[model samples]
Target: MTTPTHAHGHGHSHGHGIAPVSGRSLVTRLRSLMPLLGEHRRLIVVAYLAGVLHQLLLLTSSGIGAYVVARAAGGASLDQLTGWLIALGCLIVPLVVMSVADSTSAHVAAFRALADTRAKVFAAFERLSPGYMLERRSGDLGSAAVSDVEQIELFFAHTLSPLAVASTVPVATTVALCWFDWRLACVLVPVLLLLASVPAWLRRQAELHGHELRDSLGRMSADSTDTFQGLRELVNFGAHAQRLGLLRGQGARLAKAKSGHGRRGGIEYVATDTIALLGILAVLVLGARLVIAGDLDRSLFPVAVVLAAMAMLPVLKVTEVARELSMVASSADRITTLLDTPAPVSDLVSRAPAGPVVPHVRFDDVTFSYRGDQRPAVREVGFEIRPGETVALVGRSGAGKSTCANLLLRFWDVTAGSVSVGGHDVRDFPQEDLRRLMTLVPQDTFLFNTSLRDNIRLGRADASDDEVEAAARAAQAHEFIAALPEGYDTVAGELGALMSGGQRQRIAIARALLKDAPILVMDEAVSNLDAASEQAVGQAMEEARHGRTTLVIAHRLSTIRTADRIVVIVDGHVAETGTHEELLAAGGAYVELLASQLEGFVERAS
Candidate 1:
């Protein structure tokens, strides 16, 4: 596989670094979501307008209350009071209607944006190399796909509309207060500015705390997944208590981080409320003095105080969402980090070769190294398989047997030299086209958590029931599947846990058989089978080998005797290649490997 490189133009020794450019500020991180928001701009616009109207009505209530109190004290007529009350009632009804409409539209738009984001994340996962994916913990990746995406809803549904309304309502409220008295408007402006700066002052702390919280949650999730997957092993080893203690420690750390985050938020909250209350007191004091000096009308004194208090309300609303904004910033940073990670192999080829498919496969002076490995897994290796020929690659463990197969499958581009099928370089063909030309049965077969029929159908999604049954029978999996209570419809639990290893292998073989590709690669296909099942699978493989180029990565000596030729790989190079009897006579790597296997078999019998 291509080694992973840092793509964000910087490195962090401790953690995933923030995005090189856009991740520096909360506003920029939030702005990254605009494309998703743009998808539903109509809804967003309606939601924003409705939110503005809702806040306007709410702020208007305070002015109306002040007006009523002033007029009532001035001995207004009953008809005038009744008329004012009726007008307030009419305003309240629309306020409730707009409030509901705003909430509904905002939530719908938020959920839609969240869904689109999740889809994009999933597509990115597909484009990333499997080798790169293996380095990430399943839980951490899952949290990025699930939890992080969900956290963004707060930004879309709650933060966005309120931010929009807060930006406008405070100005509108100030203008109205200015109409009554510019002096009161001037007093309120500084207090609003100070309140708005609180989040900025706490920015660094909030980000640090938010990062800690998200990391803790991700680690805890990973630990939980590992524990559950290994529950049987933990119980058998009598280490369940120890595992539980570790999880408890993780929980404690998460709680402590959450506590710290909340404490910081609490301090900000108290400061904001204190500042808001003081602004109101300042306004009341200023208004009373102006009234006594006849600089302000007595009738408008209550109005000025109430409007000043109301103006600060929007600022308070903005401050209220500041905590959630910090969390959104942290989540966005992680998501951007993932999106920025470079794929191990780029899919740059756009079209398949125009010529006919070539069954002949060649690896010319191939060399490869896994990321972070000190030595190449395979080096300067050269081999070729003719069309319609069967070749067995026999080697001891770590001798680069599977690595060769993986190179042929293009799981990793060779670091040196070329792998070609049918005269076209594997890299030249689109990945989909290259994969379509070959079928592989890996050593460890993976079965999805689905019905047995569905698992087999994965090989050819449109294959009919008859075709699936035929392939299963050829793979010698039909009998067991037929015996199940649900027959082919039986559910295979997670990772095919409900079936024995051999059974899972047969199902995988059946899947390959259904594909009916021109090139077949089998890596230890019979490794898990018992003697009888091995014989059956071997017979099926022998039949399937006809008129197809086959590469078998074999450890067992008996399985390769009938091959057209045997190539013995020793220390990542081909040491010998000949027919079975010819190799035994040569008495090199192949003979030695065979002798060791025979010795083991004899010891087991004894």
Candidate 2:
């Protein structure tokens, strides 16, 4: 439940969840993950210690059993036999308990670290370019956040401690075996080495299949989400079968990936097991020869055989989990790639602008292009909205009308020039401060699944019920809200699905009005409303714009007529700037657009 602190550090500590280092290789990916464990790193260390203790107790039990086997038929006494039996019984309880404790602690630590990492990923999302989200599917990102992070648990909980025990116990047992008899130890060493190398031999195949499986899982998540959301539309349009067929194709691909991954896992397990069994067989054969030649004591030969199995056991432990090691590696790669994506905007940690700032917005010779674009989306676009002035931006589709609004908001920095607000560069203001001064009411404003009252209250959480109603009245949302079964208490449903497009737009307008920021940017807020609804929303829009610096990107000719000045954009530049009538009289780009709409030459609204 701990929150990661958003501070640059004097070396990393518990509060910082993101690692400073990054690399694409599996080993470096793993190294990067270590820094993110934060406070839970101590728990992983404890788990490793417990795993070692558990293996040591198991080895002790194995050695004692060999003593009874080698001596019972050699005329050993009943008392000698009973003492070994009691010692074997004494070892079992702690061994089982320590084994469970080791696994349980590792799992707890891993899951907590995963939680911390997930939280950090979400925090990173807030600072990443808002444009990045527009280019990716929500479900694909969700799979990374939820499923990918969850898969990494195998690395921390199962593989890491076992790998540690595999490294420690084999060397420790080899030393113990040498003390018993050096030749016997030498006989088992080569076979144990082969057993440990099985995973490495298949690492490439494992990585390939692992990546394919992860890709299929991500695609499945995204397609399934799309199928669900569009089910109603698909059914209505008689396209449901086509969507279902697409899903079936995806399912087949996912199944094939899982099958390939599983087949490789089986191969790894068999190879590891075969090598371990061979090591024990070699020990028995060599030990029998030594015993027959009188070069080794008969009693010590069984102990040597037991020690050989002991050496193989640790390696077997590591190779067994190696089956899932690819999954851990693949998941780690995805998580690191996302966490390492460069933040599009830097906060610079500058202080908020001083004094009573005006809400006027100015885009001065701004030029901006989206990431990976050859041509600029907005080129040399310049305009200004003085305090309390309402400016309308009109353009044909893809003429970069919305780009001007986005530039003023600083969602993406202008590539070649400055965007200023209140006579100061927008880049100098922290994003938090800029957001506080401006509110955007896009055509599709997201409404959470909550009571209507609460949804509007999101604009200003401390606003009173009376204040909420007053804002709704200003946006003409009050009448419709009152007619609902529960008035303001009615649930909005997911994305406001229960409401019509016009009603939703009005709700958004009300929310913005409630925020009462000095600057308002409405990007085609009423573009989707019908004739009747448009009139109501237009009046609401006028009410909301009073005394506020407003920027409007409108599609309807009627709405544009009310703006104090009109700026016509075409091909990413200003085509004309004047009042609606003045532009019509000038016979410039605005006149052509107006004539096109009225003469049926243009098929769509601006």
Candidate 3:
């Protein structure tokens, strides 16, 4: 069976690295992950309870210390100190247990949420039409799947849950303080507002920086992809230095962006810290005034200070989390955009009547234009291929050869006319059902970075070892495949780079044979091969075409000579249609094209 091949020019890596810590938008971005949180509410509950218990233990230690100090200053007995110490130990044990349990549970929850998110993103990608995926960059998609997804884990594991607890604890503590001393509670309110507001301001700045950082990273990633994918071209043309200079500029731009974001972050931290210090100063001045005025006793001064200091821990923890949340927020926005992309096409089951013959593909006044493009790629195109007919399309680039092939495959719906297969409108058939009826081999082949056997079996998931080998032999790939150290089991790294272009083509042909579909479409199938490999692959193509409705996009003139019918397309219109000789005799566009290639045949024959 044939391996898949990625197209050559589609890598999208724009390389600003991931944004700095302070430049993230936590709230806006991480909201999507909340649905998954709802899905695993039980796990989240357990982790949250543990975190709350840990917070309570932390609160108790400070509260208990306040009681002990207040009593000792009032000249309480030694026995009271011993009793307080025992009480503190009780809080300590549970704090230790809850900390460990919460950490472990939080880790599991993070991984589960991330794994589910990744699976869903991949499934969404599958439902999208190949035409849609082709228009996007590989690197940007990868960043969403890998880097952006990773950013969300922090929010899921801790930040979001803690926000609720953090808010609750501070308000509760403030109320309790008022019960003890109303003046202290009143003084603390304004200070808490100032601290919260500081981070809120920082968050706004972070959101802007985060958006800029993500955009820069995308550009940097796109550049990296272009550099690596075109490495051979650069090396062959001796443009290595020139390419390196270009890459260096992209890298420098990214570094400068990152540095600017970092500087902004430092400013935010300083501003927030100054606000916190102002809070402490406000508390100290207020408590001192109350004590001197005798509105509060001198003995109560330390307890008020202790409570205020204890309250700051949760407030400060939240502020720190705020910065982290901003970063996670930026990641969330990217991931959400990817997930929200509409998949207009979806898998459908075949519902044809039992024993009914499968319908042959037909196009009736079909027209299609890509989104945002002014001109239609295929317009008023009409054609038909009966069962078992080998129809070849001959055209120059952008003459709608590939566009016709794409429409017939139902990659996009025709804008004006109907496209049908087996007497059913293409839209009526399930996407999977339509796919199952056809096997496609494009000019570009994409093989996974995986074992050759696995790539071959992708054609027919249940095919036997012998069948795979037989298909490979028919496609003229078995000899070279056998020569590899691991033979059929050899790994073809990243688009089958280990194999020659001819070998990769044969493998793709083998896969089409294994699919055993009623319809086959081969676009520029043997265009990349030398004469000998072309002859072998040509024979394999003929074998594959047997008893199937075959559509070939012929780039070379010789291949279409044996086609049952040849259709000439020029400037998005059908210029001629006939057998090879009939078209030659017509003295039209096909004849002109054939005349240009006559010299090559004469040289080969000589």
- lDDT by residue for model 3 (420-495), tens: 8887777777777778888998787889889887788889999999999988887778888899999999999877
TM-score of each: 0.91, 0.91, 0.90
The number of the candidate with the highest lDDT is 1
What does the lDDT come to for candidate 2? 0.82
Which stretches of model 2 miss by more than 4 angstroms? Answer: 1-24, 73-75, 89-97, 300-302, 600-606
Where model 3 places Cα greater than 4 Å from the true spot, the runs are 1-29, 69-75, 289-300, 344-359, 596-606
- Show how many residue pairs clash in every candidate, following the order shown: 0, 0, 31
Worst 10 residues of 3 by lDDT: 1-10
Model 3 vs. true fold: TM: 0.90
Candidate 3 displacement at residue 126 in angstroms: 1.8
lDDT of 1 by residue, 427-512 (tens): 88888999899999877888888999999999999999999999899888899999999999999988788988778878888898
| Alpha-carbon local distance difference test for all models | 0.83, 0.82, 0.75
When sorted by TM-score, best at the front, the candidate numbers are 1, 2, 3
Task: Provide the lDDT at 585 for model 3.
Answer: 84
